[model samples]
Target: MSAIIQIKNVTKEFKVLNRREGLKGSLKDLFSRDYKIVRAVDNISMDIEQGEIVGYLGPNGAGKSTTIKMMTGVLEPTSGEILVGGNIPYQNRAKNAQEIGVVFGQRSQLWWALPLIESFKLLKDIYQISDSDYKSMMHLYQSLVDIEPLLHKPVRQMSLGQRTLSDILAAFLHNPKIVFLDEPTIGLDVSMKSKIRILINALNKEKNTTVILTTHDMGDVDALCRRIVIIDKGKMLYNNDIEHLKGFFGSYRTLKIRMDGDLKQQAEVIQKELPDFSVSADEEWISVLVDEEKSKVMEVLNQLQKSHEIRDMQLEEISTEDVIKKIYEEGVE
Candidate 1:
């Protein structure tokens, strides 16, 4: 599979006005424009293959949004090159628009006063979709989302979840080759989030639609993305498969064991035996934090079984959220 999207050394810079304090200073700044350069996306490069869903993540003020805008031709890059489906996005926006679909979680592209079905019809006309294709898409979308009840309702009168679902349906109505979903599940309830994810997965698998998802939700990344590209402070921090990213910080594991006898005594014994490991206890379980490189879980369990009776045990690995938090706080190692 060849790369469908290629971004090389892309950079986006903006000139932000310097606002002065107080009314007098603010009045003075109106005539004289004092500005500072802000590089929202700095020297980033990545390749996204067709039919792959890549998670684009970062902390607030990161360049995730800037990069997306550039890719969608909303904003032109200051430097470097971007090729989407062999065409420059900024240079060929109209052509690219026909190939790509976009959904902004906080913003709606639908007609505000019109019925949801009317908005979809408007999109179908704009995209020049055929009657057969429209029916096929509606059939597939209806299976994923129960959109019939809300189709006749005005978009402004619908709930957030309903509107979001309608927005997603509109984005894919054209059956574009690539999709950009920015916080598609934001502000949605758990069940709604799950439903959206399932629909996204189905689209990707069934149609081979390439997706670039920008989201703060780890659940979205975990469920839909096998590959992730992480950026912070306008720089690319990590770009790899999900498992490989986990392996970068997979040296530690947590063990929660259920013991038959006194939990505190068991914790104390384990702590004394493995002084290097961190051990704690509650009413029923003894928790041991183990560095797999320094000491193995089997080794600790072997020692514990000799002194105490173990009923059950669970070994856990580090979570994606924890790894991402560490990267944001400490920078990538």
Candidate 2:
């Protein structure tokens, strides 16, 4: 199947003006601005198919939002090509808006004083959604989110989760083929986050909606996205299956050992014995990083067991968050 979205050599740059310090400099800046081009996105490209939930991840100011804005037609790229649903996003704004839905976590689309259902109805009119289509969408959304009870309450009266759920419904009221969700689960409690994730999953299962989600939550990436596109410093770091990313960054393993006896002396001994490994010690447990080739799990266990009584032990691989951090700190190839 052809990709629903194709981004080729997409680059976006913004002119940043230098601020003046003194009164004279401030006045000068207004008249003659000292500006430099800041590359928000640098020749990044990817393909996203229908029915795929992709996690677009990066640290703060890594151009994650910039990329999303370009995709949703909110911003134009400085150079390169972008096609969403066979239409140029920035060029054909109206047509692209009809096929796409966007939810920004920091902003609320629903009116504060209006009831949730009232807001949804307004969206229905704006989108020109058929009555039948509106009813069907409401049925599916209500079944997944169970938000019917909160529909009558004003947005200001609802909790964070309730407002977020309402916002999601408003975005999708038009039954857009593609959706862009920016930190949808931010600042929500665990239970509420789970609810939103479940609703997204159900939507994908039933409607095959193509979703591009940007979040810092590793759990969200693991649960929702089969593919991940990681960016850092306005550049693409990795774009591949989640498994491939895990394998690429999952080189080091951690060994956590619980000690039956006093850990102070034993921890010192282990550290002294394994000079090449990175070690940390607490009251009851000793942790060390082991390179798979240089050191094996069995050797570490066997060596540690000779002196101290090993109460329990476990091996932990690098997590998704760790991999992402590594990429940002030391640029991934």
Q: How many clashes in each structure?
A: 0, 0
TM-score of every candidate relative to the true structure: 0.86, 0.92
Worst lDDT window (10 residues) for model 2? 245-254
Residue 178 lDDT (model 2): 96
lDDT (Cα, tens digit) per residue for candidate 1, span 1-333: 569999999999999988888999889898867899999999999999999999999999899999999999889999999999888999999999999999999898899999988998899899999999999988988877777899999999988988888888888889888899999999999999998899999988878999999999999999999999999999999999998887676577888899777888878977998888879999877888788888788998888888777899998887888678878888876
Model 2 Cα lDDT, one tens digit per residue, 258-307: 87666777777889988978778787678887877777878987887886
lDDT of each: 0.90, 0.87
In model 2, which runs have C-alpha deviations exceeding 4 angstroms?
20-28, 260-272, 282-284, 307-309
* CA-only RMSD, every prediction: 3.6, 2.3
| Colliding pairs, model 2 | none
Clashes of 1: 0
lDDT of 2 at 186: 92
Q: For residue 300, give model 2's deviation from the true position in Å.
A: 1.9
